[model samples]
Target: MKNSSRRRVRPASIASLRRVHSHGGTNNQKQRSLSTGRIGFFALLFVALYWVKLGFGGSLSTSSKAANSLGSSAPRRNRAHLSYDAEEQVAKHKLLPEEAQIIRTARSLSPVTYDKVAMSFFVMYGRFLLPFYERRPDMKVLNIGLGCEEDISARLLRKLLPKANLWEAEERVTCVGSEIEGLHSLTGDQGDVQVLDSWIEKSGGMFDVIIDDGKRHHNCQVLTSFEKLWPQLTPGGLYFFEDLHLGKSDDHRSYSTPACDGSSFVFSDHIKNWLDDIIYQGGYNSKKWELHYVFCQAGGCAVAKEPPGTIYNKPPSPNQFDKKQMLPGEYHFVTTAETFDPVTDKVTTHSFFTMYGRFLLPYYQRKPRMKMLEIGLGCDMNYGPGASVSLWKNLFPSAELWEAEYDGECVEKAVKEGKLDGLNPLVGDQGNNATLDSWIEKSGGQFDVVIDDGGHHNCQIKASFDKLWPQLLPGGLYFIEDISGKSKPEHLIDCVWPILCTHDLHHSGQVEGL
Candidate 1:
């Protein structure tokens, strides 16, 4: 059967089988292809595993570092040395112990170290009024409302005019002994205008310096004091009334009753009467006494002088009495724009929503040629026309400026324009580390005035004061606007009192604590 099968297999079929298995090529090619596929698969698996491990490990390490970093507290700026330097500068002024004591007391009352409004008034008055008294040794100074003797005004007066006698009036009679020395107190019915008149009459003739720091009985005080004190004032003397807002109160009838005496009237109506009389008749009819209204935030002061040619005789000229002169290179102007934009070549003026600008101008103008540094440059044009470099060129014509700003673009634009010549427009945040120091260093540490208008935050205001106070010139002025919003008299007593007291400067008995 095997022989028969072999015989049946054709020669052609045997030849094809031999040819198919010629060199074992098909089996080798198949084996090689399978091996290549296995190698590729293993390589891909290894790469995938390695990638997963690396990604997971990296994520864990990153998270751990982030947690550690976040857990740490930020370091505080080292201001100890700066504070010491400030203390030393104050010491150089060698302020008296009594003055220093008042300042300390004021500072202890609040967290802030300075009172911008009171301080501004004190400095300005000291600059202008003190000199007048200094030139005349026998000027009788009367402080009307002696709420508390621990103030800058009282201290400054004592220092500036050591020979001039000071008389202070209080609502209640208390011990005459205080830091101010010879403190005489008086008591009267509430809003009694006669009490002031009685005191003035008893003290003989008028005074050289009459300050109305009395109670806020606007109508009574105005009527009683205007008739009595104006005639008593020495020619060219000044009369300042505190708390003018009392005049605008609606309760005019409440100020005086039959039992309380007829000391009250419509205070606002009286002021309006005076204003109207001035407009229509070219002057008010206070028996020939010329009335000039001096408005301030704390209050308004009225100055009444007999006719220029009256028997009392006015000073050479109202301007002559004012020794204010424009500083070289100092100029000022009032523009409708709040800020100048170089790119658009436009001036954007801030709307007058309040009387801050109006009051600020007179205060600044009183100084004449003081060097000034304003933080809120365009918000309020308190410095007047020649206040900036552009306008100052025409006004002062020779003042220098060093302006630091947080907006780089604004600073760059201001510099590119000719509006700010000789002004160093420093670009950086006022709160940034070393930024204030850099500006101070660049400015050569000379400034007569410093206005904090940049950041109104309490911390920023305090920090700015801490940094800038040392740079201020002795007897120079520093203005911090918008303080009426959050600032109380106590805050200024705390921060500024210490520094001021250290220099033997004190408040004018205006504020209570200091």
Candidate 2:
């Protein structure tokens, strides 16, 4: 029943072997051998059946059932290493009208065939890019790779954005590499940072959109190129790196050449780390270009830089607040009567709150339970500290209101006088990140509206906006009051102009107004 030597035997052939006592052996021994053979045969049969059930060894019915379990109607291709489920990802995201038009335009470009469906790079363009182009039809665009045959991206941008200043950088313009007619073509290897820097110098201005469709397998080149070229991208600009799947895994090292080390650094890992640092370090707090968004998918990744300032355009609600609802009511002034009207009941108020009310009141009907954060407590003269807080509470009683002031004593005094009831004010400096973080933590992390009415100094106003703008909820309102009285004129021009002037040139669909 057992062999002394560890020799292999096929499961099918095991049954054909001679029984231990079958060759004229005793009856008892023969009977035992027969029993063992029968047991071994049944054991082999069970394993074969189990293998068939698992859709192995040509079990068509079982294989079909296994395929159906994956929730795909079409036959599945081997996509084991992909970062996303193709069908599921495609199903959830619908292309916008402008995005769809971008794909159609790319496909219409002759000779070079693009991916027909979910695999199209132009689809990604439509999702992340169309907004910028739609906002600024005359924006500058740079495509890094001009294909040997027809250049789809170059041709497509030329067709869709007729007024856009389009440029293409080709490694070679030999017989194989054909240059397009309308776009500005620069000859240089994109792997060289000098080449990219020179392109910037020759182009004369910063690009609003940059596409890297060159040398997909060169990981180090891509990273180095990004570092050099990023500074040249305009504020609120976008940079797209295509064919990321090529360098997403370690095995891609096989594709590396002597000049490029693909596996020495992973492109996706670097992008992820950069994004994490940008968020954790309050990167937007600086005036320098900072990462706003990093979107990675199965094919490639797109990075968007933060603008110096944010311009939000809250949509006009059909059920807007009436004049009576937004009108400022009576407040107990420390100097005047105990209860006197600020605006509607009497014309004795010195404030811009009435003007701001027109733009702010619509939010009440939009989000009745909206949360608002104001940087200044205004707790000094007359109706000190929590004075503005009282106004907000009166306007949107159902909303969660918060105020941050530099003076803790002013807040304590306001509370002692029963000025701040049903509220907990934050006492900290707006210029400090620690104070901003403390306010963020105490106020449930995010806000629907942020008002900078604090010091009104250049640095104070900028720091508050940079730190808080990222935390503001989508479609949220961010207001910087008294810009005409900034600490320095250059501060307003250098910092405020980019945020306000570019209102008509980026994310314009959701941008209702400046």
Candidate 3:
């Protein structure tokens, strides 16, 4: 516990786990707080924008002098003297060398906060946005909420990344099709995903940078934008959520869903919970979604999407799982299908290697003598005994594998027929805690990998995970497949979510991907 990097779960009490609820205020009190919050929020925004507009030191006319005042440590640029070509480029709204210098200077300044209000989103610009644009010059950007007539942040973005296409969405902005310089305008409610999707379709590409500055008071709007648009963002893209200060002053009340205590939904608390759930559901262990980097400040938060493996230039691993091509595991799976028909017999291909070949390959390769435990042995009449065990043996020839099945007669039959030769078998009910404990004891108290290809019932799965997951070695994998067959809603929301949430709570909401 002292070293946060090491995660060890105590499985005994996992069943009785509970989520601590966050409480807020009544509707009228919340509305009053929101009003006060909004006023302060805009005041800070005005100050930040006004500071940038005045060129940091004060007057826009003396911008070059202001840039020089930042000290010689700042990037050198001649802002006042511009060549004929440079002036024309400036008139065209292209990023000039001088403008880029000023933008960098603005972002590098120390963050300024007052009364717990943090206003400098430029910190994120320097940390994430700048490097990204530098890498992809013609990047597409989506900026929601065009504040005031000037819209300073959008304007700065356009000036900084001149070649980049900038899309601005605001409910009040009337020009939907109008394009000024590189900035495209789309007028609509920021909460509406369809409105943004239409613009994305028209643009013929996804965005590299997305900033949500609109609808600061609504958590549901933020959630909707993230869920619908995150997939639309290019991998390695940056997404920024600004003005989190509203959550502090507005008592974190959401306009839509009520909090668990019957008050309005707590925006800050709930969004974090949702994000933690996202990390658990699509973590590094899974093949689909990946969150590469997550950083949060008092004012805002930023999430970066990790690029896919296929995008890498490296050659594919021979053991990599590909449904299109027959992998070693897949080949063994098909060859072993004579015991049971995959289609007509209606037996799911519950082979451990077939189901988790991609994830298990690297671990198996690293430790050829790795120990593995599988909760179910596919002992039904349709499946035939030890089918998965056979596939696992073929794929992981050197692995010490153990298959736990409820039917003792099935294990006896497989052993008698030489189907489970050189395999460790534990015959018992998977739902019993004592049975799970005994299995752990018999097959060594630790494992590099544990798979639940078992009963597919909620009770059995929960029992196995609760007992085995804690016993899994550090950096080990615990895979649960065919969960859709029979997991109860209550079990997931109560037991699974809490366990995952607890494991992640120690991790500070960040799941580092492989």
Candidate 4:
């Protein structure tokens, strides 16, 4: 019977017989039976184990491997597929060129390659928080120091919160400190604080955000933080202190050591004492303020707020103040006419108003129907792009634009050129309150945007603000360009603080009483 069955059974495939022989088969019949039973048992065990794993939520190696393969495949799938809608959106927003450039720059200067990890981290922090701030148009911002020529923070804020007003103050050193070169040129003339204060008081509002990016003098930090900064901040506004490591005395002395000349002014010990006094003694009210002392990899960060004070507090004196009058030589060039270069046919390099007018045209295109005003248009609005009357007409075709050129020649030239179509070029000096009042009256006291690119002098800015801020509609935006002059220790203490304090008062009152 076995022989007959064997004859009827098809011969085992070579592969199956090899496996059976490898198992050390006793006899052909026995080997077949044993092999079948063993295979069945192992299959049953595998099935049971797999069922157990699935039922108990355990992940098997094979399953994990399969998941990883899927994960790898996803990115490949995404790359293979292109969304036309995304491309269209990019093109429609005109975002590709700038966005790509920004991305390329960011990748090249990535934190991994950058040596200053702490600064990188802070920058990331600012980037992370910026979007939230951007959504709130009413939120005010203050940037204390204009660190380095390329201020990353300022650039970020400008891009993110294009409409939000940012008050940026940098400490001006009479002579550049040895620790950092190329800062002397950026310093504002001495006594700029007084001008800054005058401008702020005149402007009639306070900053929503404040940043300290100036020299790391303990006295400056203390005074600016406690007196100038805190008092000026709008309720719920933010103040950021950058390069806090400079606040250390040890580092201060080291910085001073490299100075061969007497121009070096080291204030590390003074900074330490000031910080110690505030931190230890609760110099800033604990109840009114929420202190965030973030010891980040980049540097020390301190965020503080007043409890419930009106923004109208008296301006605190900055520890350092310079009283020297600015000379015309200090101002590289002052233009009273909107002259064009014969070679390039572009506005002369020194023409501020012309540059402003040109810059504003494209911006106006992006945000159409927005009302804008140029304060202190010395000679045909020449600080930023919209300063040129011709540029302004082309930029805001459908919107109302106004230019306050103090000089008659530029205003008449702008009118003659037919560049002042929608622009109401008023003859007035920002220095004189009556002139500003008359100009505002002529324009009807309502503007959505105000640019104080005029009068790089601090006091002129203050005067313009006093005359113009009331005319700014609620949720309107204002800009004070070229305030690079507040770097002097004296100007910071005297002028800038006072103006900031006055604005604080206005902002506080608007928040509370209004």
Number of the top candidate by lDDT?
2
Give the whole-model CA lDDT for all candidates, comma-separated. Answer: 0.39, 0.50, 0.49, 0.37
TM-score of 2: 0.43
* CA deviation > 4 Å runs, candidate 4: 1-367, 378-387, 485-514
Candidate 4 steric clashes: 68
Global Cα lDDT for candidate 2: 0.50
User: Alpha carbon lDDT of residue 280, candidate 1?
Assistant: 20
lDDT of 3 at 278: 30
TM-score of 4: 0.30
Candidate closer to the true structure by lDDT (higher is better), 1 or 2: 2
Misplaced by over 4 Å in model 2 are 1-93, 116-120, 175-179, 249-261, 286-289, 310-514
Candidate 2 lDDT, 1-514, residue by residue in tens: 0112112222211112113212110000001111121111111111111112221112223232333222213322322212233333333332234445654565456743353223334444755576456456678988777665556556766777788888887777572344555578777766676777788789974889888877443567677668778887887688998765556445444444345566576665566455333322222232344765455433556777754443112322322212211112111111111122221111122223322432354345446688888777775535334445544655567888887888898787777766667666888889777898888888875687777777755556656665776676644556654432332333332324222211112111211111
lDDT of 1 by residue, 258-289 (tens): 43333345443344344322222222222455
User: Using Cα atoms with residue i matched to residue i, what is each candidate's TM-score against the true structure?
Assistant: 0.38, 0.43, 0.42, 0.30
lDDT accuracy of residue 464 in candidate 2? 69
Lowest-sum lDDT 10-residue window in model 3:
23-32
lDDT for model 3: 0.49
* Candidate that beats the other on TM-score, 1 or 2, i.e. the better one: 2
Give the range of the ten consecutive residues with the poorest summed lDDT in model 4.
505-514
